[model samples]
Target: MDIDVKTLRTFCEVIRTGSFTGAAHRLGYSQSSVTAQMRALERQAGAPLFHRLPNGVRLTPAGSTVRGYAVQVLGLVGEMEQALRGPEAHPQRLRLGLAPALAYGEQLARISRFGRRLLPGVQLALRVMCTAEIHTALRNGDLDGAFLLTARAPRRSRTPATAGGPDPTSVAGLARARTAVLAERACGTAAQPGRPTEVLVQELEFIPSTSASTRPATPCRQVAVADPDCPSQRWLPEFLRLRAGEPPESLELGSMDGVHATVQGGLGCAMLPSGLARSPYGAGLAPLPGVPRMQWTVSLLAARSREIRDTHREGLATALRLALEHAA
Candidate 1:
């Protein structure tokens, strides 16, 4: 049977709020109207969806099943609405994501340049998050694009290099340069044949139960913190791998500042992006020899809509490219 989007929304709202009155208040609808909508949905499904108790309402088995589907449907519909509204109508809010530590230095300054020159009217929103959150935001249409440290795109196809040469309009120029070792002085430390010198690595603590694919593929000693829900924690392990191997012993810390302090104390080594580590405000830490080097690429993404004006799309692309170049 065909179920109306409105009816499903009303059903989901009632389930979410636990009562028709609560849903009505949240949706700005009259209590009677909300009840009618729920009743209509039940009739369409040919089942009593909710059991009305004296104090509240409980979802029946069928109602619970339908509610699950309704949430997905409503969420997609909301995303579609936002996607169709061009950047202009939406004030061109660019939701840019970056690896936690990499959000500092010239990289941030370059992004600011794009917002000021290319998209003067657009609102640029910067988010420092793990690779997983950035990917999930792009897939869900919450982010315009992101600069990631990986070689590949997590969701969309990679933009090709320019035909004649590297496209000046591409974001590749802004991609971080991978270098072997970053040190103030070159000291010759004779290479030992077999035993790999132990280096300190910092670990990011991510929320538990997150998808495995989103986690970095590296070995690390897990550390427990008061609030394990922080996103920076998830990225800590990967950042550590960029310079050293998994830490043997885990240290539970309260804040990011605390994590940095712990690393500075020489209690253990921590891995941080070059852009972040080399920032003016950075804690002075010497880069040890045999450290691994890596880089992340940032790109702008748009939907394939013929109706979207070419000038606007190209303008956005140019701004993003220039921003990356400035950062480089």
Candidate 2:
């Protein structure tokens, strides 16, 4: 059977949005074009795909099976395009995306300067966005690499690596990206002040259903967080759950800066990166103890494929480690 990628894409989009018109609008194709493409696809497959309906379309049995194949085909095409675009030579620019609130003040300055020193020819284009978005761009070939947060840290009690290189991971997936751990930091409690200097993780239970002595009764127990996609946002609240096992109240914010300001205002305490906790921004907040440590690893992700891999990756990773050390 013969089918074009565009036809398969149209089929998938129609299944996704459940309407030809919706898929056409989303894909910037006319209704006739989408209909013709679907017709072509169905002919190639020798089976009907979508059952036309009064409200929205539904996938036929054969279409359901083909939908899975369509997804895999499209995903592979994306991976191939992304992998082939990566080249070792002096790139137009090293587009590096990072999570927002990763570093501020002095640390941020050092990151930019270090990039210029290490990657001379390529312009350093640093943009701050959520880690998930950074990862997506990295996978899509829009970025050369990214620094994103990962929760794959050593189990609590601060165990050191036994030996060897990072427990070895294979780089396989649509991204075809190689990842290296740049730095590791645990999540620590940060608030305005007036809490115990050394409270166990369990002691956070005392927080909910009670007001801080300094803060308002209503907002005192709230937990501030970055985007929901963040590892810290997902793990911290669960780690610091109430004695009854219910998640505490939360105040969501778009950036870490907003979280800090909210905390300073006595609205809540947030789970901040331990490295940043030691920074000037986290000046006074005390780290809680005895928690099943939620350690976060800053990972350097570079696009990698058999044909072309970034040559400057190791040098850039080294520079990043040095900058992080200086910041710490």
Candidate 3:
């Protein structure tokens, strides 16, 4: 038979408190209300569960049997309620997608703080992917939210818009600006030959590749070939495509550390973020003249339903807004 939890609770409370008046007081109900509830419970059980006695009220044999079950059931119900509402309840899991470029700066710190403050019990899952991949994941529901580049005003229309319309004013816009400023400062410094400094520009050409052989070759330069899969490497072809002349010739190295070592050895320049360049490695590197500024934005994406409860999405957006204000 279908049974209401309230009925069970009222029965258990009356038994524990030993009187209808006491149960009403503990449950914040009037004694009359408590009496009515017990009457209802007795009707449901098809028997009078309590016997009126001189001292107070005593349980009949049937009442005593049901009270045992009621106690256990009510105890379980109370525990379940507390578990759902408790401060120590397990956090909801949230998946967050981010572009490699934005992961390097204050975004990380801001997001961390936002999580600690706003979503204390959230389990954050971070995925670093390219802009295209992030968008795809968001559409597929594999990602609850993402930070990627946006080119135009976000519209509610079915067709997704392209990138690079007017400059954005959203949280993503601020991130782009911050990234651009960092890129500009990091790339502006041109490296001198035989200097013990770290350079923060991407190595566009590595040893006899199309980029290296075609670009205009500079003198007194050492170059290291980095992994093609690196985000820094992905930007090189585009950088060269934008340049007016032939690509420069240079050595190809595998890792970021190798490129740093090469630059430290006074071999050639390496493109890097200003935060990294200005850090310990950039001790002596100076900005090059006329370095083009480059910035990218990361957008948030989610289905309507999943997006509603996405704590990370909200937290990231808040953090992005704060970062933009501070950067501004």
Candidate 4:
């Protein structure tokens, strides 16, 4: 038997509110209309969905099964309607994420220009985010794909198996991810003159205190990090404190450019992706001492499933690859 969409919706609302009266209030319908619609729905299904309790209503086993299918149907209908809204109503849209360190670089502007030129009529929006947030958004379906910087998970982010399974979209647990390595660059500590030239990001560990082993060779450095939770360098403060065993003095700057400039000005030092550290923009700062050489990987990642396998996605990925190669 065919089910009317309106009646199905009313049934779901009734189950949700646990009372016909409440569902009517929520749906802006009268009590008589709600009862009538549900009665029609029950007649079509040939089953009584609710057991009338003195306090409220309870779903029969069949109602429980139907409720699951009702949710799925409604979701599909919503998707279909959105798709049908057409360019006149809802323009084709894609949310592309990039780490701020990458966003402020030549890559983002170039890719955006190229996308506008190549994919006419597509609304390509930019989302600047930390690598971790980018991964989380990708998993949650908030972002379509991104140029994400990959790094090791911080100590606090790790947990035992029982706590929860790894989030599927997280970089560590990314399974159905289709990706292309956009670029590979090492991260380094930004230094002033006379500071070490190639050390690990955890600089304070090399310096010994009263309880520690050796004194710092250079001046105790001030570190500058980005303030926004989504900025590429947001992880620096934590990484420094945890890995270095002793935290250095840190300053939080508003933007990635601010962090770069602050490091170059001899005001403080910073941890930077090699791309940023070596760029002409960062010429004033020197590399820290001792080459720990941890490579920061930049990748264009999309969900492996049905979310992003289409002409627009393919075009965006291709545009990114070509632009990055030419820049390199």
lDDT of 3 by residue, 1-328 (tens): 4568887787767765668878888999998988888888888888787777565575553564465456445545644664587666646656666554444323444454565577776655555565555545654557766554343322221223323322222323333344344333322333522111121211111111111222344432333434332333343332342343444455655334344444544556555444434432243344322233234233454434443364545665666545434322
What are the lDDT scores of the predictions, listed in order?
A: 0.45, 0.53, 0.47, 0.52
Give the Cα-based TM-score of candidate 4 against the true structure: 0.45
Tens-place lDDT per residue, model 1, 22-110, is: 99998899999988888888888898878798977876535644653564465457546866887556655555655444343334445
Worst 10 residues of 1 by lDDT: 178-187
Off by over 4 Å in 1: 1-90, 105-110, 151-262, 279-283, 300-328
Which of 2 and 3 is ahead in TM-score? Answer: 2
- Report the backbone clash tally of model 3: 36
User: What TM-score fits each model?
Assistant: 0.37, 0.50, 0.40, 0.45
| Candidate number that wins on TM-score, 1 or 4 | 4
Arranged by TM-score with the best first, the candidates are 2, 4, 3, 1
Which is superior by TM-score, 1 or 2?
2
